[model samples]
Target chain A: MVSLKQLDLTDLSVRQVNEYLHGELLEERPAGVEILNPDGLHSIAAGLDTEVEIDILGHAGYFIAGMNQRARVTIHGNVGWSVAENMMSGVVRVKGHASECAGASGHGGLLVIEGDASSRCGISLKGTEIVVGGSVGHFSAFMAQAGTLVVCGDAGPNLGDSLYEATIYVRGSIHSFGADAQEEEMQADDFEKVAELLSRAEMNYDAREFKRVSSARSLYHWNADAHQEY
Target chain B: MCGIVGLLARRSDYRDDLGKLVTPMLDCMATRGPDSAGLALFRSPLETTSRRFALYAANIEYDWQSLADRCQRELDTQASLTFVENHAALVSPVAVNTFKAWLKKTAPEVHLLSVGQSIEIYKDEGHPEEIARRFHFSEMAGTHAVGHTRMATESAVSPAHAHPFTAGEDFCLVHNGSLSNPYSVRRKLESLGIAFETDNDTEAGCRFLEWRMREGDTLETAIEVAQAELDGFYTFLMATADKMVLVRDAFACKPAVVAETDDYVAVSSEFRSLAHLPDIKHAHVYEPAPEQIYSWSV
Candidate 1:
């Protein structure tokens, strides 16, 4: 049987809970940590470097699971801004909607939002794999260096602005693309990648329905002849 | 950063518990803004001929009865006042111009917070929790209320600079982000011979909206104009006697979440502040989209 421990926030502050998560849990090695009554408090389960499965039972506040390492955390309710921001290597899944900047600046991780994600989702993303079951808001994947953002639903305006290397696959409509981001035909490898990510995210989208968006490479060089007119 | 919170109960059954329901929401947002706090409570409109004047003083022990007596003597009118700490709500049949002239001459030190048939404001410079307790926020009752906890970035940290900035009658506005074009907005309003009390950016937006309303533009129309004219980031929560309105900038650099149920509609800069509301578990919660105007009428 998996050892399950409950951390009820009614009697514990987030500081106390995090202290326990950071200190004793490493030694105790509980198989799972269940955080009860999160009630939209910020920074729950942040910086966890364990392989334990964590469950937050209520709506969580900003920066939850931020900078996560090895933990596989799941939030049962909605989350505030910057969820999983600056993550290293981990898997964080939000069952409900996420506020702005979800999975922002992550180095490595799989962040899944089953519901809609607000503006700037995966912003400045570096090598993170984000699969959204629902739509993504405006300016998503802006200035991304390297990653894969798969959207099963519509992509908002200015999607993947100033992109480099990172590939975006959208199964739904793209309202508009950013300056250097344009759509291309999905090849065999692209279908395989989208299928793998969708399977990991537990989404049911057919991989062939996805379209690829990548950099046009126009912004890579500075043009001295043009007088700043795009 | 600053915090903005507003609550409007849908049914009149919840009207008497408005303060109890909203005080904690205001207190929880102290993390976002801890320097000063203010609230504008909109009671049901009074059917009488008199208006209520919300007043504030720097010193908590200031003599309010003497000032009231002198006002009654000078204006030869009957007025009644209730004071708690440094704040008071005076009710009388006096015209706004007459009251302003009398206050300028007799009690220039006391600050006039708001004047309306329903709106009563209480604000001070301190920790929001302490100030909320001092003003007896939990005991007051109203149909709706708009509150703010301010962390001043572009202006002084004084009571006058605290949020829930009011202009004209029952209208008040609170902001979470800074405005970059306040000077130009202020310049245009000032050119029309309009006066200003503090050099706060939110006051500029508040006065501009009220001026537009006075010029026969509806509140929605005024906000549409503001969307075009106002620049910079903002998540503004505004209230009049019967309406609670919210809006965000086009970029939505700031954040606002709203929770609505059959009982009430609540708004905050973040969802954390609204965690403890009754029946919140089943409320339909969502973030207000960028550049959208959301209004709830009582």
Candidate 2:
């Protein structure tokens, strides 16, 4: 059986809550922890390094669960900007929609958004796999260095701009693709990768309908003749 | 960074709570922008024949009553002025253009913030809560409203730099990003005989829309043209007498979220601004597409 702990945010300030979660209190590493009444305040559960599960009961504000390591942080309601930014490992799930820069610049982790994600989702991602069950706004996966991003719904304009080694999979329409990001054929192996991602995110969708987007490789090497294309 | 919020009531029951609802939304984004705050409220027109115009005074003790009395005697129409802090709203039984011409000739010092049948604009350089408290926004009622909190990326922090810049009668706009080519755009509009009140890029964009509308373009066409011409990262929340318009640039660097329910429609720079709105949980929340104009009319 897993151990459970509860922290009520209404009675505590954000700093106090963060201090308690970051200090020796969580050193025992409870299996699951519950945070109540977040009320959309900012910086909840930020910079957490524990390998425990944290469940935020209500809406969260900006930078929630940012720079995480080996912890599963879940928000039951909507999330504000940069949810799970620069996470090194583990999972961060938002049950509702996310605002801008969701899962931005993460080095390693699986960030699952059950609902739509706003603009700049997974911006400058580095080795993080972001799976969105719904659509994503513009500039998703912008200048991503590595990892994979799967959008089950439509992607807004300028998806995967200046992409570097990162892969994008979209099941629905794409408004427009950014520079150096182009469509690629989804082979059988690509389907397997997308299937594994969907199962890991616990979302149900048809992977066969997804289109793959990756860098054109033309921008990696600088050539004087290619200046106009840039 | 800046924050913009707009609320339009789809039902009559929500009209009375417009200001009350928008105040909290503006306050939620207080941290994003700390330089200044402003709002444009659209109340229902009174039963009388007078049109409403909101004016700004250079000082708090400006003689607004004398101006009203003089305008009433000279224009030969019933006129009234209600003072609020450094601003006042004038109601007069005269044509808008005629009244504006008279004011320009007589009271050169007074600045016209807005002139319409229902719109009243209040803005100042301060915290969002302080500005709202001084204007008594929580006690006012309206059918629709737009609020802006400024971070002052492009201009000096002053009352003239506050947002919800009026373009045409009952039309105003609030923006949340900087423009790269506002001076050239301003020059182009100036050559077309459009006057500017401030050097802010948002005012240039607002006047561009007004100029396009005057050239026989619809609001949608004007926005589409703006998308092709304006070079910047912006998320704009614009309002007319009966409609609210939302637009993001092609890159969509600036954020905008919209929530719609059976009773009302609200748009904000972030979801936190809309989190406390009534019936928001059940509402359909989504982010608007880049360069696509999303508008709703009552």
Candidate 3:
């Protein structure tokens, strides 16, 4: 039940603060918990099972709110790698650019990166809904098992390299594809998902402009000498 | 440049969370190191006598199976043949001191990486996730774990050129830069029966460390020796069950950042990945000195 604003976190490391507040804020926490300086440290608010409302003011580092079972983390600046990694549940919002693997391997949650994200934004991602207002780096969603990744800007190379069940909607050009990935015309279900994610991110974009990329599931297994086309 | 990551945790810790706590952190570098990714995890009840080998054989041909068979036959008695792939992990129940002697006499072309009880390795020719999905890398759960993501420069993409090259059990490596003077040092290791799988510069680097360690040097000393012997713009990361070593070559061409707190420590190729911590007001980030090697043992 500690508000991040009142917590005297000046004396401890980022990890130390996380350790100190372990399990103290959960399930709709008070709005006072706010981070004053967010440099490239890491794993802030990780393993939080509480529904605490934590607001960060600057750029953050990797695995922010990682493995978060519950809790709401909001960042006002750009974010680094895997912002909401392996999130079992909860909501994370980034007001600026997100580095690579923004929501990678996430299980379930709503992640909003207000700006661009670098490569592999949702790799091995499952059940999570990720929305990016800007472009994504190469090989985004390489092995996405399930869930949805919606990008408002351009996408980088090898989009969905080994895509699984997940669906990706990009408003930009795709660099290429691995053996099992391909670009498909957007459908109703795809439109719905993109619309929902964009709305969750509080973005107002035209869903019709995006294209869907998914797995062809053609070369799932290695034939070695075959064309290796997906 | 390349990025390498490994993990070794108590078995009790594994069943509790299923690698959920660490995989995302490991996957965070997919862009910084987009070429390829690989990881090996080893469980405890680990052996202290096993060795990890990094052979740098000369005149290696496309006939990998034949060469591997020859290696097995030559060191058949002392080296019990286990799984044989492009790379193999062996359990050395024999005395650690005598194991190299047996290898020198049997398969003189073998360059030992390290020796220990349990070992795991994964590598490939694409981005980290590409390699990870190809190998189902995250399935590995052990007390000891290590991973690498490549950005191919001096080496081509091939299985033989992949990392965690075995020289002995429990000793494994993932390198992130290139080596100069490979031919001369490779020839030296080859003279001592260190066989290589590919012409990749990293192979030579791994072999040099193994040879030094075999000559009665500790991991630190061996790495130091290799640092002296090899020339390159490199940053090499090697992991053992109880220790992790980071070696930055002359000029330190690659980027490496290390962050640690009382609870845990994490290292990555960039500063942004570590910026999210709640209390890192002035997150102290620095790079390794050229020709200097840093090691941490748990």
- Identify the leading candidate in terms of lDDT: 1
> Which has the better TM-score: candidate 2, or candidate 3?
2
Report residue B179 deviation for candidate 1 (angstroms): 0.6
Error of 2 at A87 (Å): 0.6
After superposition, the stretches of candidate 1 with alpha carbons farther than 4 Å from their true spots are A225-230
lDDT per residue for candidate 3 within A1-230, as digits (tens), equals: 43445343345678667864574443435555787666655787888887677787766667888888778888876666678999999999888777767888999988888877776789889988898888877778878999898888888767888788988898877766655888898889878878777777899998888898888886566777786433
The per-model lDDT (C-alpha) reads: 0.93, 0.89, 0.67
Superior candidate under TM-score, 1 versus 3? 1
TM-score of each model, paired residue for residue: 0.98, 0.93, 0.48
Q: After superposing candidate 2, which stretches have Cα over 4 Å from the reference?
A: A1-3, A27-30, A172-177, A182-192, A205-212, B47-49
Native-interface RMSD of candidate 2? 2.3
Instruction: TM-score chain B for all models.
Output: 0.99, 0.96, 0.70
| lDDT by residue (tens digit), candidate 2, A1-230 | 43887888879888988897898556666678899878778899999887888999977778999999988999998888899999999999999889889999999999999999988898999999999999998889999999999999999888998999989999999999988899999999899999999999998887898999999977888889876676
Question: What DockQ was computed for model 1?
Answer: 0.79
Q: Compared with the true structure, what per-residue lDDT tens digits does model 1 show for residues B222-292?
A: 99999998988899999999999999998899989999999999999889889999889999999998888
| All candidates: DockQ | 0.79, 0.48, 0.20
Model 2 docking grade = acceptable
Return the clash pairs for model 1, or none.
Answer: none
TM-score of chain A of each: 0.97, 0.95, 0.90
